[model samples]
Target: MSPTPQAVYLNGEWCTSDSACVSVFDRGYLFGDGVYEVIPAFAGRLFGLDEHMARLSRSLEALGIVPPLKHDDWLAIFERLLASTDAPDAAIYLQVTRGAPAKRDHAWPDASVRPGVMATVSPIGAIDGGARVITLPDERWGRCDIKSINLLPNTMARQQAVEQGCDEAVLVRDGLVMEGAATNLFAVVGGRLLTAPNGPRILPGITRGLLLDLVRRKRLMELDESFISIGALREADEVFLTSSTKDIWPVVEIDGEPVGAGEHAGRAGPITRLLDRHFQALKTRRSDP
Candidate 1:
């Protein structure tokens, strides 16, 4: 073990990650009934933490789970965990789940059952160059708004992508593209940028939201929240995926065909590159203490 003061906050206590224990009867384990948020940290500082907390609170409210702690309490916990991590690039993962009940049951009405929370700071994986993608039917539940711990469909799709030598999977509902297996989808057609409107179809990714704000603030390009069909996505001039950790990914190809045309084919295009640069600049603002 390195000499860094590393530990994880579990339930109401802070302990070493190895010692952070959870009761077997926890609803998060038994029923996948929990919500989670990942707030990206650049260097040692948090980026868009308020936005993340707002999303987390919305998720908790949607699931009928009470807010385990106030805003100040959460800030204290997150900052403490980050202070223990020396990673240049890291993220704060916060999860809140319906507490372990006294007995195993599908539904528990006891208000006394407290929620279980786990918070930690971990290194963010780096992605080199562009990403290859495979599209699949969006076979997830209706309430994608809530960042619930139940991610069976997403995990399966991601695994499928891995088996096919793809970096990520874009999910399609009906005939329209909903989102990626874990990230939000953005397609550049002609010269205009388009992304799925926030709703049950996709999770309001913190990175995605920030990028949208940047685009609007900078007037970088024409953009819309209109739905994108699979055909449109396949024919788009450029495509990208955004998440809390990975930042942005320029999709060079889909299925087996190359994205874009001619010279820029199978490569990161102008708009995608522009957004990535600006987004990185935004991250730097939060870097300095």
Candidate 2:
């Protein structure tokens, strides 16, 4: 793939992608002491950026790291980067760390390590029809709510899914479905929507919120977030995964078992179709003005 022509904001300067690089001594690299947020942009406008930024700020506070830039400053920087890039649909990635210091120790740095903020935009291709997912035993820490950079377990799970000829991996904790490795999981059972509740078990996903809203707006049946077992998913009316990059992707099958195979076999269900249209309409409206 060609390198994206997106501009990047580093420290204080907004420059080309090639010029963006953090210091070797950055704690984020040495100890994974940082947080990041991915904001999806449709057409040319950022979608739910304020929420993303709020999450980022919260992550920083949770990490005891001050935000590198003011909220408005960050927005200005993101807009500049977006305008500099040519991608119509992009995922804006922002990473803030405790900054670099010329030492490696377990203790936090004594002084304010300049928070490192960097961003770039790239294209989001068409959403796939459906995705195959393999379930993995959840091995992440209890603080998954923090959105920290320590993603080894998730990385391995995602890679394992790829190796297993699947599009994504759903993480199961103690035989209960948690969420996807990189996305959130949802299920339709008995014509009702089901998903895990917001807690330490699942990272609150932006697309997940949108899907819930769309379902509510349609007056379709839904269940308050709760634990869903893998066995239940296999017997459910439908299964799907949502994220910033993929939106809502139906899961016709999981781990070789067909979900919602009777009438909605190998296709997006009615609820899925409805939300898909709502999501697209939102994108179109944003793309227009």
Candidate 3:
């Protein structure tokens, strides 16, 4: 496919992707000293900007990387990018790294280095019925809480999944389910919602939060937000996944093996359809002219 020209913002200036470059000596590059967040824009509106920014702030705090601008200042830049982007739907990529310093050292620079911030927008696409996933042993750091720039493990996991003909890889940590490489996993057990709770190992997901609330509001089922084992997922009544990009998708199969109720149990289950409606309602409400 041909590459598309997307606008990029870097260190307080707007430019094309090629023009938006950072120094190779930057700590974010040399030492992986940075944090990033991806905000989904659906129908020309940014989904959960506040939540994403909040997580970004938390990541920066965890890494002790001071933000170059206040949260409001960051919002102003996002708004500009959102308005200027031509796509009807897109994702906003935000990254902040401890700026380039004169030398490379394990310790922080004597003076606080400016945080390098960049933003970019790209087109969005359909979610479909969700993609198949392969399970892989978790090799990521236990502190998956912070969304830092250290993504080599995640990259490898996803690539492994793709090689196995899957869309994503569900990371299993010692026989227990952690999450997907880029999304959160959910399974219905006896009509109850179950997902890994937010902790040092799991990154809290914005769309997962919204969907769980929607399910509760409808009195359909309750979410446990507790850890579940691979056995539990294999025996689940229904299985699904959520993310800013994919929204809600029922996992009809795993590793070519049936998941949940077995052989497409949750494809269009009653609860699944209801949540799908609620998801549509959310988008329609947000997209109203």
Candidate 4:
């Protein structure tokens, strides 16, 4: 991926980050009234375009914002952005916000208002595993599945983890493992892969979906899309989090306690490593359906 992004696309124009500015009254700025997508491109090929775009569409529709571009239009924009970047593993971060209105009114703006569109590219840097994560309350709103720009709760939780010598924050809602701050979680309990299924409590991650597919298609292990209680997750044989940028992050410790059992205890266990191996191999597929 590009070592540094030279420019960002703002309102259909390419400009440096310092020069890319949105209106102060922009709904995304004033009220976090926008949705975003973070799609990764590997080896100059866009990864999971269909899946990401589908989610983007769903988010926009859920917010009652008319989609600004068609699938082909989005693909073209992404291709152009990828061509401009130097890295073979760059992330495309794009967002659509309700445009700034004349007045900062609480009600929806008039139909004449155009949607604000912006995009940027960044390198997906190296990630060292053996992540230590802390379980915290998921205080996010009921619509966690929308992929909205509002991430204050998640940000705060992650900050707390960082201050506590941890790498990530696993959110627990109603005593059940929901997901990580910005990733989906998987726990190996009794030799079975247990992950919180896609719902209002979890943000459906592209990498999470891929890993699940890999395990199922390859019969790597018994899979279940259900919640593992926070207590069970802290005691899991293996734990991991998946994101677009940071793939399989093996959770070596949870809340200062070691993970796994037997010889694999306190380290990345066998099942997690097996899935990571297949995940790395699967990433080589230049194109995904």
Q: Could you say which candidate leads in lDDT?
A: 1
Q: Which residue runs of candidate 2 sit more than 4 Å off their true CA positions?
A: 1-6, 285-288
TM-score of model 4 vs. true structure: 0.95
Q: Pick the candidate with the highest TM-score.
A: 1
What lDDT tens digits, residue by residue, belong to model 2 across residues 24-92? 888888888899888988877888776687778778898899777887887887788778767788888
Candidate 1 yields a Cα-based lDDT of 0.90
C-alpha root-mean-square deviation, candidate 2: 1.8
Of models 3 and 4, which has the larger lDDT?
4
Question: What are the Cα lDDT values of the candidates?
Answer: 0.90, 0.82, 0.81, 0.88
Tell me the alpha-carbon RMSD of every candidate: 1.9, 1.8, 2.0, 2.3
lDDT of 3 at 177: 96
lDDT of 1 by residue, 1-289 (tens): 6544457999889898766789999999999989999988887788998899999989999999999999999989988988888787788888999999888899864889999999888888789989899999999999998899999999999999999999999999989998898999999997898999999878999988999999999999998998999999989999999998889899998997899998889999988999999999998876766
Tally clashing residue pairs in candidate 1. Answer: 0
Per-residue CA lDDT of model 4 for 1-289, tens digit only, reads 5444357777777787766788998999999999999999887788878889999999999998889888887787888888887887999999999878987987989878888899888888888668998889889999999999988999999999999999999999889999999989999888899999998889999899988888889899899999888888877889988999888989998888889877887788888888888998898864554
Ranking by TM-score: 1, 4, 2, 3
lDDT of 3 by residue, 92-155 (tens): 8889888888788888874556878888877778866656888889999877999988888889
Error of 1 at 156 (Å): 0.4
How does each model score on TM-score? Answer: 0.96, 0.94, 0.93, 0.95
